[model samples]
Target chain A: MKRNNDNIKYDSKVISIRNLKKAFDDFEVLKGVDVDLYQGENLVVLGRSGTGKSVLIKIISGLLRADEGTVNVLGQEITNITIKNLDRLRLKIGFSFQNSALYDSMTVKENLEFPLRRHVKNLSTKEVNQNIEMILEAVGLSQAINQMPSELSGGQRKRIGIARTLILKPEIMLYDEPTAGLDPITCIDINNLINEVQERFHTSAIIITHDLTCAKATGDRVVMLLDGRFKYEGTFEDVFKQTDDEMVQRFHDYNFIE
Target chain B: MKEKTKSKFFLSKKIDKVFIKLNDIWLFVFRFFKEVFVPPYEFKEIVNQCFELGVRSLPLISLTGFIIGIVFTNQSRPSLESFGATSWLPALMSIAIIRAMAPLVTALIASGRVASKIGAEIGSMKVSEQIEALEVSAINPFKYLVVSRIVATTLMVPALTLYTALVALLGAFVNVYQFEGTSFTSFFVQVFEAITFLDVFSSVIKSFIFGFTIGVVGCYKGYTSSRGTEGVGKAANTSVVTAMFLIFIEELLSLQIINALRIVD
Candidate 1:
């Protein structure tokens, strides 16, 4: 596997998880999982449905606390930090949920401007409008600025979700199933956009998805989560070569190569 | 023996459930106070909620108040005439409308309208993960969603009650003129004589308490909503029911306080 060393430096761990475990009621979702993310690297977590991929990201972002062990994000342990400090740390991390989760009450412009107006106060109207235009342009949705989330198509909503997160200029990005319910073409478009975002912003990202196209298109390294832990870790080529595990082999076989 | 054990288990479970609910509401109220006084007040959301809870509710409350005044006056007229105290009609009607009917009716109406709406909106937001989105953005969802809503209801309910009182008195005047040929001037004179500072103050205080109850209960139900789309409906239903119950409890307490203070005859 070829490593991109351009943005790497000493102390390259942007996020580190050690023996993380989480359970909902009696169901154990994550049982002693461990992972690390380096600076400016796109790490894709591949898992089937209900394998705790989204849970892992939520734990890292402090949206959900782990049952045991530790999650270190940006050199701060998130498991035991105060809510005020967690909120402060959250500003540096942008999370795009699976459903795009746009504020249905607001127009696209308002939704995109929400984070900017909240975090960066005293910004002039001109600056706010400029930032909104720039981010919408990046996502190719400048025309839909005045539209509401309900008015947008599924793919458009996803792009708008990505645009809203990107407007914050976060150092770390966590995308949970960014292309879960889109057409193949739209999925490809989103995958390409993900790669472009990583390259342009130099952000370290952890993309949680089961889509092989997305993983191949954007991931520098891939990890397959199974039975509450990372069962496989390698490049896309290395993962495809593994046939010993039935689940991993099924994932490989299910992908329609173009 | 098995039946006895089962009954005991059920009773304990019921008690535990009630205590859990009380604890949840208490914590929700604490969080509201803590977040409401903090910085970054959501002024725009508060204004929006005021518009929704106050302005939008005017027509329904006005109609309800008018009907209540007409019915109440018509019902009380025969009894007063039997005692040769027909002149006391306006005063009795005014006191009833101002002290109890206006606040209780307006609160129940708002509990059905505003409380249900807040519960459903917030519950749907939770179901769709919009609340989580707000949290991930580092914005305080409780302050933005709950505090502004509670503050708006707390302020607007009294305003609505005052408006209801005016409309109800007007209805009473119309009803009186139809039956007894009492002039508007005489009727209003009797009403003004009957009303006191204590009556208005007590009514306003009760409305404020009822409004706070509706807001807090609605927000609590919605904030803790789970189980997907079905949960949204359940939250809306439970919010209205719980808020109306609390309004009655507040009314009872207010009456006791008024009697203690000799504010009512």
Candidate 2:
């Protein structure tokens, strides 16, 4: 598989999350989870609902603090960084929200411009508009620029979310439930867009979703979460050939329904 | 025998849920302070929120101000006339308004309208996981959400109070003429003679504080909201009530301070 970043060697790792733990009250959601995201690779985190999949990704992105352990992203230790430094680190990573958390009151243009305006310094208004137009076209949302988020469909909203993330042009992208609420055709559309983003922008991505089609289409590696730990982590073939795991077999079997 | 066990199990589960929710809210509050100054400032979003939360809510504040001014004038006119102090209407009314009524009443209305609206909007966003989405994006939710809201309230509330005072004075003018056939210039002369600069300045400054308190407390409660729809309702309800209480307390404290200054003089 061609990696997203040509500047870095395929074997080099970009994100190293070691022994991460997070607990809400008495219930521990993640118990010593460790994962490494290689340069340019699309890693799909698959899990049942409430199995801490979102929490795991959140810790890596510096959104949620891990109860213990380390998250080193792009060679920086995120856990111990100062507030100012942490923000600088964040600008290098883009996140597409699960429910397309576009600012409801903002127009599509404003949503796309939100990060670009904040992080990009000395950028002319013309340059900003060009970037927005390019990202919007990439997400197939040129027509929806003036529209409010409430005016978009579920799939269109997700694409806008993706567009918003891409406007930052970060080294890494985190997608939380990017295809959760879309139809199959729409899911395919999103999957194609994700692949296109990886191919064109060469940005490393980690998608958190249980959609098997999404796993097969966009993921270079599938990591399943069960009981707050990774049950399986491997390529699609590695998962498909295995007969020992019932959940893997069930997912593989269900893939034929399409 | 099994029935008793089941009921006890359900009771324990309910209690456990409440404790966990309370725990989450406490943790979020602690986290809010920690993340407040972190960079990647959500400038565009904050400005947009300010326009929504502050500017858009101005109409309601003005309406309340207008009504209060008219009602105060109408009610106080006959009583002052009995003491042959009818000409003191503008002075007395202006003092009543600039000193106490405008800020007090505007804050109370804002507690009902803007505070509750903020609570429900933020509460819904929290439950829907939008706030979590913001966090995972490496954005500091506290600075993005709370600070923007507080700043908006601090700026808007005083402006709203000022507008309310102006509108109310106009309403008082209408009331005076309708009742006593007094011209507008005479009313102003009487009002100007009665109301000290201290009264206007004190009232305006107090309204600013009231605005800040309402916005901060309303956003705080909403940001920490839990328990689904029921929690959202509770947050909105408490935001208004707390703001109303704070406005009253602030007014009383300012009054005491003013009295102290008068006594010293």
Candidate 3:
């Protein structure tokens, strides 16, 4: 399942976080974390639940601001930027939430169109329709376009959620547990979709998951987060096999069982 | 001394919670005002919410208004009869409905329906990360969700209040005709003569405040909801209760302001 990233281009750093520190009161979720996400590469941030995987991505996307350190996302330090300015920067970053986070009030088509209509306000009706149609087809959920989020299954919802983000045509995608709560087949399908998204769109992504299979399938380069810092960094096999630490092995085995 | 200190400590904790809540509300309202006038106004969303909060609540408002009017008319008949003021029935009822009962009834009903609906809807959206989804999309969730609902309620309450005044008048007329054989035109003529422009204006202004109160309380509760799924239920419950509580406070304040303004006039 390890897709070769030998040919994947890394023209520039899409995201570079140096000494990123975020905490909730005394709980230091991400402490002095440093990471880089390069262009046209699917960088998987692997960690167990509550291991700051989601928090890292949230900071990258500016959903949650880092308490300390510089998070340079697409060349802007998010911590120093105002919300109005950050929103402009956020249009370039697509964040798919752990629960898919589709607007329950809206149908799938509306959910997809939500981002498009907001960011690209001047698109013609024809162009809007084309974009919706194209993105829905890309996610392979064109049939479920009119259905509400509640009507779709977990996998379908995740697909539509990715489609919604894709409609914005972001330069970077941040998938937060895109395969968190799905069956093995659905997980594989999501993993394949993540890879296809990179291949087709030629976009950089930071896929956060504890699922080893997902990381191997989607990630071009993998990093394992332990104690709020990456303990292993390399290809999935290199990181997993090259590590001699018992904690890293235990985490890997634990992740495999889960 | 120890018991007194403990009591004081608990009291201080309660006060601290209130102060923190007040600060949050101040910021929330501040943000609401800031976003409301900003560009990219969600007019379509505001209109849709108005349709949902306004047009959808009309039948219920009308029914409640009518029943209130009939019951009030029946209850006041004996008192007026004893005083030889039975002829003043239409005028008295119209005055009371326009001034007090109509807006109060409409807002109370809406607090149950609209406030709880807004609370639960937004609370669920918050828990489900739909609000964050909008934020990540560069669409302001506060502007789209909170402002739109607030604008809808602010507008719809007054409109519903106006409609209730008319419906309640009709109900009062039906009762008057059934009991005392008054004609439709006669009852309306008496009602209209008794209701001044100030009465109409005050009712409208009061309803607007009631609507705003309901909207703000509902949005505040729902937006700041915690405890996940359980939070959503608590949000709906608290929204209804808080909105109703604030509505009464607003009603009293509006009444006092109106009385002061009348004296000035």
Candidate 4:
């Protein structure tokens, strides 16, 4: 597997996870995993199902505590930070869940409005509406402003989820399986959207996905997580060249077959 | 010897599980109180929850109250008539309804309806990672979701109980007029004479306690739910069961305290 060469230099580290370990019951999900996220880079963590990709991002976000090791997000050690500080840090990080996770009781407009109203309390109705309009237009779902999550299709729901997270203009974005369970065309659309978001917002992101196409489209660096630690870290082209590795070969063969 | 060891191990595991659950719920309660008093109170959410808990529950509460009143009067009438104490019907029925039946019945209904609703809603959110989404968005789910529902239930349950008592008394009036041709005015007077400030106060207190219990248990079950969709269903079911159990326990304790206080007086 390819590794990061010493020739490259990152501008500044936005997130640094060192010797992270997490276990539920007797099952260890992350075993001394370490990674660094630099500014304005999309670091795609590509792993097969059940590889604890989501767990790693959750630990970085401070949603789940690590049993061992330290996670520094925006230069703040998340493990020891107070809840108030964690919350302030969270306001700068947006998470787009795989299932969209929209409030089922609310309309699309209300779902988009929720974060703004909570964090940016002084925003007036007109400003909020304009913000919502801009995001909905960016996601190309301005027509669905009044619709409920249940009424929307899978692709629409994913777009709305992205829109909701982007409304706050978070400095860091964590997307958990952004294109999972979608048709090939829809998957491409979501991948393109991810690229567009990266360019538009200039936000560093950690995208957890098994889709190689997504990694190629959005990742400046693709890291393959295997056995609870990163086994490969390089460009998407470097990943394609590592066909001698069994797991990487298998992933390429399976994904490239179509 | 091996069998005995196995049994002991299982017993200890069960005990550990119960204690862990107790500790989790206790911590949840403390966190709720702490967050409730913090700044940025969610008045809009609370108002919305109140409307849902109080206004939407009116029909069911009214129906249960009326039926309970009629059934209770019918059941108690022959016994009173046998003792030639038919004239004491309104007083006895009012005392029973105000002191125990109304609060207990209303709480049970609220537990079934509101607790299950809260549990299912929050559990589904937990399953779908919406709670985590809120956390990531800098929104305090406990304050926005749990506290609002708890406060709403606390305020609305007593209001519902009062309405239930009134409907029950009206139902009792219907039964009384049908049997003895007694005027509504006399039945009202009799009921008012029997119901003291203590009865009203105790019923309100019990309802408040029941409401708080329902809110807390429901939110706890939902917030901690695991195993995905099936866990949501389990959370809803367990919420109703636990809320009902707690309501009965609260009622029993309140009754004992009221009796002890009366004896002292």
Best by TM-score: 3
The runs of at least 3 residues in candidate 4 whose Cα sits more than 4 Å from the true structure, single-residue gaps closed, are: A1-9, B1-11
Those runs of model 1 whose alpha carbons end farther than 4 Å from true positions after fitting are: A1-11, B1-11, B181-183, B263-265
Worst 10 residues of 2 chain B by lDDT: B1-10
Q: Which number leads on lDDT?
A: 1
Predicted candidate 4: what Cα RMSD to the true structure? 4.4
DockQ winner among the candidates?
Answer: 4
Tens digit per residue, CA lDDT, model 2, B37-64: 5554556656776687667877776677
Q: DockQ values for all predictions?
A: 0.43, 0.29, 0.48, 0.50
Q: Pairing residues by index, what is the TM-score of model 4?
A: 0.93
Q: For candidate 4, lDDT tens digit of each residue in B90-138?
A: 9999999999999999999999999999999999999998888888888
Q: Estimate each model's TM-score.
A: 0.93, 0.86, 0.95, 0.93
A best-first ranking of the candidates according to their DockQ comes to: 4, 3, 1, 2
Candidate 1, which CAPRI tier?
A: acceptable
Better of 1 and 4 by DockQ: 4
Candidate 1 chain B minimal-lDDT segment of 10 residues: B1-10
State residue A44's C-alpha deviation in candidate 3, in Å: 0.8
User: What is the full ranking by lDDT, best candidate first?
Assistant: 1, 4, 3, 2
Poorest stretch of ten by lDDT in candidate 4 chain A:
A1-10
